[model samples]
Target: MDLAARKYNFIQELSSIDENLLEKLELFLKTNQKDWFDELSIEEQKEIEIGLKQADNNELMTHTEVMNKFKKWH
Candidate 1:
């Protein structure tokens, strides 16, 4: 189904839910609405920072180069 139709159906379902469920759903949505990066480990964040710095410095290799370099792993 399309997003609009799905949203309408979801709203219809939400209308039938009790106040307690609606409050819990609201809290769930609010608590879960964090940036994905904020959930990453410190090591992962450092690795991403390093990659971004390398990219900014134009220290990138081509897709073919990366695939060829790591081909043996597969």
Candidate 2:
């Protein structure tokens, strides 16, 4: 089938789905999109990249190490 025909068929099939399923589909479509990184500021993006580089270099702290440090303050 042509793209237009396939789109129409898809819409037709989608319309017959249950309301709750349709709502869940809409939520999934909204939340699963790829535009979240574009919403971050340049500085925030740089900070995330730096943290990722640290992780790549195995420079991150473990949960126990972080908790131990935190315990010293209390």
Candidate 3:
């Protein structure tokens, strides 16, 4: 039938399953595989890397400090 009916039927069938079947279902449900390996662009990736380095060096301040700095920037 429709998507909602199909999903509801799947959930009902899943709930009726034994513990072994549930375990197998759990693996399929928990797995997150994507088609793209590198989702971020080169620039975005570099920005993330730079942020990580800043954090490692303790150059990134606390939340309050960041808020104060952001207000100053404006």
lDDT of 1: 0.98
Candidate-wise lDDT, in order: 0.98, 0.94, 0.84
Model 3, 45: alpha-carbon shift in Å?
A: 3.1
Best by TM-score: 3
What is the C-alpha lDDT profile of model 1 across 1-74, one tens digit per residue? 99999999999999999999999999999998989898999999999999999999999999999999999999
TM-score rank order: 3, 2, 1
Model 3: lDDT to the true structure = 0.84
lDDT of 3 by residue, 1-74 (tens): 99999999999898788999898878876785553426888888888889999999989688998898799668
Which residue pairs overlap in candidate 2's backbone?
Answer: none
lDDT of 2 by residue, 1-74 (tens): 99999999999999899999999999999998988778999999999999999999999999999999899788
lDDT of 3 at 2: 100
Instruction: Work out candidate 2's RMSD over C-alphas.
Output: 10.9
lDDT of 1 at 55: 100
Model 3 residue runs over 4 Å out of place are: 33-42, 62-74
**Which pairs of residues collide in model 1?**
none
Model 2's number of clashes is 0
Query: So what's the TM-score on candidate 3?
Result: 0.64
The lowest-lDDT stretch of 10 consecutive residues in candidate 3 is 29-38
